[model samples]
Target: MGSGVGMGMGWMWLFWVLLILGVVLLAVVAVRAFGGGVTRSDRGDGRMSQERSRARQVLDERYARGEITTEEYRERLSALGEDR
Candidate 1:
C-alpha cells in the first residue's frame, strides 16, 4: 500500500518536467514564428530587389527602343509592382 505514495510522487515529477519542456518548446516556436533567430543571409541577399530592378531596367530600355507596346510594358511592370 505504501508503494502507491512513490507512484504519485513520480507522476508529479513527470508532470512538472513535461510542463517545463512544453514551455520551452512554445518559446522556441514563438521565436521562430516571429523571425527572431533568422538573419539577412537567409533571404538570399536582396535577390528579389535585384531581379525587380533588372526587369524594370529592361522594360525601360525596351520601351525606349519601341520594341514592346506601351500597354504590354505597363501591364508587365504593374504585375511586377515595379512601376513605382
Candidate 2:
C-alpha cells in the first residue's frame, strides 16, 4: 500500500508536466496556424494581397461547408473586398 501511494504521487507529477507541455505546444501551434505576424514580404511575391486572397479562399470553403451562414459569409467577404 505504501509503495503504491508513492507511485501515484509520481504519476501526479508526470501528469502536471504533460499538461504544461501540452499547453506550450498548443500555443505555438495556434500562433503558427493563425499566421502570427506573418507578412507578405516573407513571401517571395512582395505583394500582401495574396495573403488576403488565401484568407478569402478559406472563408469561401467554410461557407461552402455550411460552417458559416450566408449573411456572415457576405459580411466577411465584403470586409475582405471579395464582394460585389
Candidate 3:
C-alpha cells in the first residue's frame, strides 16, 4: 500500500509538471500571436524613420569627407534604395 501511494504521488507530480509546462507554452504562443513582442525594426514610434534619416545623414557626411568614393556612395545609396 505504501509503495502504491508513492507511485501514485510520483505520477501526480509528473502530471502537474506537464500541465504547467503546457500552460506556459500556450501563453507564449498566445503572446506571439497577439504581437506582444518587440520587432527588430520599426517599433511603430517613428523612431525607425528617424534612424534611417540619421543613417542617410551619416552616409552623406562620409561622402562629403571623401571617406567613400562616389561610386561606393552611389552603390551604397542604391543598396539603401534611396536612389529612387
Candidate 4:
C-alpha cells in the first residue's frame, strides 16, 4: 500500500510537470501567432536591409577587382540608390 501511494504520487508529479510545460508551449505559440513577442528587426525591414548591404558589398568588391569600369560602377550604384 505504501508502494502504491508512492507510485501514485510520482504519476501525479509527472502529470503536473507535463501540464505546465504544455501551458508554456501554448503561450509561446499564441504570442508568436499574434506577433506580440517579436521585435521590429525580426521582421521584413531587417531582411531588406541585409539584402541591400550584401548587394552594396558585392558591388564594391566588383569595383575593386576592376570587373567593372568606374562609369559602370557609378551607374549601377546609382541604380541601387546608394550614395557615394
The candidate that achieves the highest lDDT relative to the unseen native structure? 4
Residue 53, model 2, lDDT: 79
Q: Kindly report which residue stretches of model 4 are placed more than 4 angstroms away from their true locations once superposed.
A: 1-42
Clashes of 3: 0
Best-to-worst lDDT order: 4, 2, 3, 1
RMSD (CA, Å), candidate 3 to true, equals 7.6
Write one digit per residue (lDDT tens) for candidate 1, span 1-84: 665656777579889999999999999999888877766634778786787789889989999999999899989889988675
Pairs with backbone N, CA or C atoms under 3 Å apart (clashes), candidate 4: none
Candidate 1: where are CA atoms >4 Å away?
1-42
TM-score, every prediction: 0.46, 0.44, 0.46, 0.47
**Candidate 3 structure, TM-score to reference:** 0.46
Q: Write the per-residue lDDT of candidate 3 for residues 1-84, one digit (tens) a residue.
A: 455656667578889999999999999988988976667565677787787888889999999999999999999888777994
Of 1 and 4, the candidate ranking higher by TM-score: 4
By TM-score, the better pick of 3 and 4 is 4
> lDDT tens digits, residues 1-84, model 4?
455656667579889999999999999999898966777656766897788889999999999999999999999999888968
Q: For candidate 2, write residues 1-84 as lDDT tens digits.
A: 455656677579889999999999999889988876556566676556778878898998999999999999999999988786
Model 1's alpha-carbon lDDT is 0.84
